[model samples]
Target chain A: MSAGSPPGVVLDPWLSGVARLVEEGFDQLDLLTAVDLPRDGVIEIVIHLVRIEDHAHVFGHVRLPRADPVLESVTSILPAAAWHEREIHEMFGVEISGHPDLRPLLLQSTSGPPPLRKDTPLVARVETPWPGAVEETTGRRSRRAVTPPGVPPEWLGEGS
Target chain B: MTQRCYAVADRPEVRVHIRDLGLACCAVEFASAIARGLLIPAPEEPGTAAVLVISGTVTDALVPEVVRAWEALPEPKAAVSFGACSNSGGPYWDSYCVTKGVDTVIPVSTYVPGCPPRPEALIDALVSLVVPV
Candidate 1:
């Protein structure tokens, strides 16, 4: 539960620890965010508390059951945490139970699964990586010529 | 800085009022061109002499906005698909939100191709607008 270095402990349910950190004079919520670990079937939420006066940083990690993860909003403790909570709700699909405005942040008005989820497929076509072989003179074989397999040649010609 | 006016009566170097519809990285180049005086912002109200210069990976959410802007520009309006994103989905062609191309939504007069076209390259496209054959 404790941080890797300095000194800290991972609170079972960060809701209370968020309050405890505020009580200990860590007035600034440096960052509140979550990560999607599909392999673990959990969303890991991490909150960082900073005391500018002492330049102390305390990071707390909490894992929620990805199937139906939920957590109390920390906005009550740190209003600034509201945006980050909303971000996690959308990106990691973690439910911030008491968030006043869980409305979309970076994702404009749209509905879909969290884009950050490990399993979430990239919706955009990435650039075709440069092929390692220098001279790939177009002489068709089984597949297309321009880009190698796995790389889309959609960007190759005037049209796909 | 080049000036272009598409006025039928006066043709006083028509100002290029560009309504930028950004989808991704190319928006940066679009902004830079504006800084170089290659383009100008459209008036507060729609239906002015303008071009809907779309760049980057456009998501499905922005289709209606593009249509609305294109319809609003006063007659003699043109569209410039300024990046790979708009010409095709660009690299993001595979994305769920990215629209395959701008031509699907509106007529494109000029197509500037690049992952994110450079400011100078965009100037070339803008030049095509301002300069007459």
Candidate 2:
């Protein structure tokens, strides 16, 4: 953990430095996750690793610019990173260089924009009639009718 | 012996609970019937047939417990992972407390795909596995 940061340590020189660390120290790459910081126009990628004895569990983070977020793939260094990096790429559109295969692991090919992107708007869920149920349109806003429980009203539709 | 079964809609019941709890720490109530005897045996049977229902905070330590429980079960059993927390490890997947998915610990067969799948869906899954085609 870095002195200034909350609980995470920020790696300098970003992807390259982290790749070197993975190569030299940790042989096993456990997992990879990303945090979208749209406010800063950057995405933070966290890489976790553990040694054989599980004594040394370390994490490294790299921040990529949102404009063209790209980083070196650690799949070569650690094979487990393949799916993790693919998920990150699909969700955030982060480019991973030298990746043996870079494809959308989760999202469908025909799906619209990335759902997890910070700027992408969330869709509202509409409850239609089962088979032949009538569509009820009252004086109330269509947004409210389709709004599912627990889902934010704002994300449902435009404010009426 | 007699068996009792309950059914609930996947839409309103399951999704509502999942939303209430959030995927991070959602808890799905397992029908006591299934939990009483479901077991995960060894990996020798090619495809380990056992459903590992998971929810709440899944940790690395929890993996061993699940594996041990599964290993103790009889052969030719399948796993039905109910709830988002169990299937994809839910909101806590990326977090430090949760594993990405329960599959990391034990093999999974069917993923119910909800924070908590409706009782009806759970029943359907159970029936599909038990009832022959």
Which one wins on DockQ?
A: 1
C-alpha positional error of residue A55 in candidate 1 after TM-score superposition, expressed in Å = 3.5
> Candidate 1's residue-wise lDDT over A1-160, tens digit each?
3223223567677789788888888889887887777667777788888988889878877778889999889898899998998888888888888889988887764476677776664433234344453565578744334444444343343233
Over the stretch B14-65, how does candidate 1's per-residue lDDT look in tens digits? 4565567776778888777656655554334444456677777767788887
Please report how far candidate 1 places residue A52 from its true position, in Å: 3.2
DockQ of predictions, in order shown: 0.40, 0.04
State the local distance difference test value for candidate 1.
Answer: 0.71
Against the true structure, candidate 2 reaches a TM-score of 0.47
- Candidate 2 lDDT tens digits, B47-123: 33333344445565566766666666556555666677777657544443356677777777667776556645565
Worst 10 residues of 2 chain B by lDDT: B12-21
Candidate 1 reaches a DockQ of 0.40
Alpha-carbon interface RMSD for all candidates, in angstroms: 3.5, 10.7
lDDT of 2 at B4: 23
* Model 2 C-alpha RMSD to native: 13.2
Model 2's lDDT to the true fold? 0.57
